[model samples]
Target: MSDAVVGQVAVDQLLEVLDLKELGPFRFRGVSPRVGPQRVFGGQVAGQALVAAGRTVDPARLVHSLHGYFVRPGDPTEPIEYQVESIRDGRSFSVRRSVALQGGRTIFFMSASFHRQEEGLDHHAPVPPGVPAPDDVPTMADRLARYPDRAGIWAAIPRPIDVRYVGEPGWVAPGDRPPDPHQRVWMRIDGQLPDDPLLHACALTYASDLTLLDSVLSVHGEVWGPGGVVGASLDHALWFHRTFRADEWFLYDCWSPSASGARGLATGRMFTEEGRHVATAVQEGLLRRVGE
Candidate 1:
């Protein structure tokens, strides 16, 4: 199949995953992709939880921030039930908490805050200078072609996001990627999306988890899987600063400040191609060498 056709199919599948089924008041259920890892992807859960939270809030209120913790590995074969709590509904702001459960056990929980759009003083950090445009970077397929042995399941899976890495990805061989403190990439949903702002936010939430932790490994020239490091996301947080479409190209500028005791913390900023700083994400994960 052509890349464009594959991208559309992948994106349709992703949308299906994100479109949770409303079971009852403030409760929903979501499913995993038919083909994926044994464990559910963290981004799927986070995005579904956000969707649950967003459903209970006033449409006028837009989600501005979300903080979530991954408590246990999620089974891809089982359905996830998201239970949302209406924490508060103030005059200008609303808060909701969502808990994702499987077999009646909590797998993930999150607190999201929404706000009515209002005028505010605005200033944002500029995009780093000397970074190449999205088109100038190598596509994921191009990079993966160079390391076929390492591609493994990644090559077979459908990718919903078109990612162009500014430098080496985490799957590269040790020492192949020179030690770099930053991991920059340009990405966007592989297909077009509707105009709903909440949908865009939820979409970006799903995309956010894909590469944030790679910054930690990139800083040390470490890779993922056998002969390298393995990790699980412990917690994730995101702050939406402005409006942006998930289907359009955006730069993900990420870096790690510390990694110790088998844990790493990384932060990233998302900016539109026009240099509009739109969002920020922070995550900490448990990282350990294979068989450690």
Candidate 2:
């Protein structure tokens, strides 16, 4: 099959995964795509939990922010049950908390807040300087095709997001110098999505976790691979600042402010190609070098 076809398959499968089965007013069932190694992906859990929260709120409301924790590694072989509880409903604001479970164990938890869209004052930081335009960057697909010998592991795994790095992808080459504290990438869903805003938000939630943690790996000039290093997210938080679409390209600019005591803290901002700051995210993960 063609690259476009290959990309579409992975993302279409994820969209199907997000169409959760409504068990009741406050409960839903979601399944993990049985592909990624070891356990289910963290982004999948966060996106699903946000979808669960959105289901119980009024259609007029939009998610403004969410804070979530990765409680445990999820079982890809089993289904996850999402239990959402209504926290509060105000005139223009609402809150919901959701927990994702697998075989009676809570694997993830999230608290999401929603708002009725209204006109408001707005200001945002411009895209950082010295970053190359997304058009000039080499896409992940291009690099994988360029180096066939080094691309096998990545070729075998087809994820729902298409990512293009502006500079050196930390996972690419282990260099002598510890990288600067930051990294940048362009990203978007691999396939077209419907017009629903909530689905777009949830899709972005999934994409957010794809490479944000790599900011930590960049700090040490380390890569997570066979006998190289190991890490997982401990917590994730996102704030939606303005309207955006997941199917189109967005730039994720990330930096690790600090990393110590086996825990690394990283923050990121998501921007549309037009320079709108759509969302911002922060994550803390356990990072350990276990191999060469």
Q: Backbone clashes in each candidate structure, one number apiece?
A: 0, 0
Q: Candidate 2's residue-wise lDDT over 34-101, tens digit each?
A: 56556888999999999999999997999999999999999888999999999999999999999999
TM-score of every candidate relative to the true structure? 0.97, 0.93
- Total clashes, candidate 1? 0
| Top candidate by TM-score | 1
lDDT of each: 0.93, 0.86
- Quote the positional error of residue 292 for candidate 2 in Å: 12
lDDT of 1 at 20: 93
- Residue 118 Cα positional deviation in candidate 1, in Å, after optimal superposition: 0.3
Clashing pairs in 2: none
